[model samples]
Target chain A: MMAVTVITIVLQRNLFSVVVLAGIYSFLMATVLLALDAVDVAMTEASVGAGISTVLLLGALHLCGGEEAKPLHRPWLPLGVALVIVGALVYGTFALPEFSDPLAPFRTHVIPRYLEQALAETGVPNVVTAVLASYRGYDTLGEVVVVFTAGIGVIALLRRVPRREEER
Target chain B: MKRQMVLRVVGKLFIPYMLLFALYVQFHGDFGPGGGFQAGVIAAAAIILYALIFGLPAARRLAPDPIVEAMVALGVLLFAGVGVAGIVLGGNYLDYFVLDGDPVAGQHRGIFWVEAGVGITVTGVMLKIFYMFAGRGRSLDER
Candidate 1:
């Protein structure tokens, strides 16, 4: 369904319709997250990745003069990369343990204890919160830094100074 | 222009609650399905609604450009500063428990504040992006 939406957007001439389709693709990906039992992530994906990000892209289209009639340059390259990646993932999935398997290597690891012990030990009820804020907090800090850098990228892009040589 | 539309009136009613609810989500994240990221997005949504209805300039007036940019930088710096303090206290980088005599209690305290920083920065950055996309002038906000 997501692939259909993306392809529809790519093929469509109307920029607004393409943005709407992109939003739909994001909504579908959020559903996939929910199906995979990552509800918190799904919630974030729905709100941030789908809702705000799509709106941002749409707003950009307004400025960029949307919808070129030209064909995509090197479309087959992307298609080739995507197929190889999908094949790799499909093969890798077969080796993975089924969900909720008690004897799986995942359950035997510290992750299970992290979820089980977070509330009793850290007083943080949400295990994701505990893991993100505690055990692997340094990485979370780095993630925040990445977000900060994105903000800087926008600022630097917006704040372009004209060249002295171009001045009359 | 008889100033009335669903977008305008509903947006007026919803924006404040959205922000308040976002704050609640940020603080209560230790116990619930939400956290700084969720809260930040919710808050940004509220402002975006305001921008969509009233206009980008009014939203920018509510939150100026430089202030927003500073928040984006300062928030991460504040969060990292906490971790750096922990590092200076002779623990691994971002080791929060080292901030107190009891590692567990210190971890909770540090995380709460750090998440707040994340929420603040994210809110500013999201709003800034919205403003940037809508453009710099103040045409659409007053209505």
Candidate 2:
């Protein structure tokens, strides 16, 4: 389902359809995450990727128009580079431990400690929340700042036009 | 403007539930499959749905640009403040253990505030982006 969406998005010339397809792709990815039992990530992907991003893209389409422009030059170099990168990543994945292996390095490491201690340490029943908001507080704080910066950037780029007219 | 009666009625009925569910996700995150990030996005999405149905100007009236902008900064400040608070309380930066006399309670308190901060910022960011894109190209008279 996900691969089909991606292929259709690539083949489609209409920017609007591409955006919609991208949303579908995100929804499929979210379903895959849910199947993997990463509910938190699935929820985020559904909301941010499928829902908000689709709206934002539509708004952008309103400004830029819905049809995609044909490329003036062929993208042979970038395509080769992308394929090589994908190949490398696929090769690297071969070295990864088998899925959900009990004796895997990850399973043997800090996760057991977190599972044992997170409830007592954070008083939060959800281990993901405890880790995100308490144990990895600094990282979450950085993420918030990044989100804030994105808002600032969008405002800076888009908000000034109306204010400039007002000044005149 | 020709407003669809069915859309108006259905949207009115649905928006409240969306907002209520967002709150549930926010407050219940500690015990569920949600957290501040998910809750904030859900809340922002509710408002965006409102904007989509009722138009951008009406949505702006409900959540003004100034307030939304303030929320973005305020959330970051709140998060940083919690971390600074840890420093002032004689623990390491962002140390939840020293937030109160009881280490466990302090951890809870710290996580709560930190999550709230994340929620606020995420909500603000999502809404701000929506406003920026929606406000462009269209004039009030056109809507």
Candidate 3:
């Protein structure tokens, strides 16, 4: 279902529809998360990915050309690079720990301690919150910076109205 | 504007509560799976919903340019200021012990203030970007 929407996003020419398609994509991603028994992740994905990101992307679309982005040039270099990445990812999937493996090495690592003491340390019931706020606070801080930078970058890129051309 | 009474009334009823819930999410991130980013977006969305229903001009009026600009600097400053406090208290960056007389309490305090900072900046950017979008000559209202 989502694949159709995403492919439509890529293939369609209407920029507004593209934003709508991205919004649908987020909803689908949230559903996928719920199917995997990751309730908290699904919730966060729905709230953040669907709600905020869709708004931002739509707003950006409005500020710029509200038209489907046209490719600059059909270059095979980027296509080849993307193909290589997809190939590598497919190859790597074979080595992945079987889904729901109780004895997976990843399940028995430092996460156990973090999970055990997460509430005591941060007073948060949702382990994801504890890890994000306390255990990996630095990364969250970095994430904030990244968002800030993206806003700045977007404004800088779009505010180019050729200085010499006076306004009405 | 569509004179559909339901959307107009529902938007009026829902916006205030949505803003309140956003604040709650921002402060209660420690106890839940939400934080500054989510809260800011929710708050921005509420305002956006208002714009979508009431009018874009009204929304832009509610949040002006200067407010958005100040918020950007304030968020980054607040985040860095907490780290400075930690440095002054003989610890590494963002140590949070220096925020208050007590270190543990200070960590909580530090996290709260920093997250609030993040929320402010995010909300500001969202509103500002929306304003820019709505201000464009895409619609008939803007001359």
Q: Please provide, for model 1 over A12-125, each residue's C-alpha lDDT reduced to its tens digit, 9 standing for 90 to 100.
A: 998878877877887899899999977768878888987888878877776666776677576898899999999999999999999678899977899878978887767788
Best prediction by lDDT: 2
lDDT rank, highest first?
A: 2, 1, 3
Model 3: TM-score for chain B: 0.90
Better of 2 and 3 by DockQ: 2
lDDT score for residue B118 of model 2: 91
> Across residues B1-143, which tens digit of lDDT does each residue of candidate 3 receive?
54778999999999999999999988887776677877888898899888878877677678766777678767877887777777887878877656677655676777787788789878877776666565553342333
DockQ of each: 0.48, 0.83, 0.41
Write candidate 2's Cα lDDT for B6-123 as tens digits: 8888889999998899888888889998988999999999999899888888999999989999999998999999999999999999998898999999999998898889999999
Please state the CAPRI-style docking class of candidate 2. high
Query: Which residue runs does candidate 1 get wrong by more than 4 Å?
Result: A1-7, A35-37, A72-81, A161-168, B1-4, B88-90, B136-143
Docking band of candidate 3: acceptable
Two-chain complex of model 2, DockQ on C-alpha atoms against the true structure: 0.83
- Span of 10 residues, lowest total lDDT, candidate 2 chain A: A159-168
> What tens digits encode model 1's per-residue C-alpha lDDT throughout B17-135?
98899989899888876788888888888888787788666788988888888889887988888889888999877777788888778788888978888887898788877876676
Better candidate number, 2 or 3, judged by lDDT: 2
Q: Which candidate is the best by DockQ?
A: 2
Which stretch of 10 consecutive residues in model 3 chain B shows the poorest summed lDDT?
B134-143
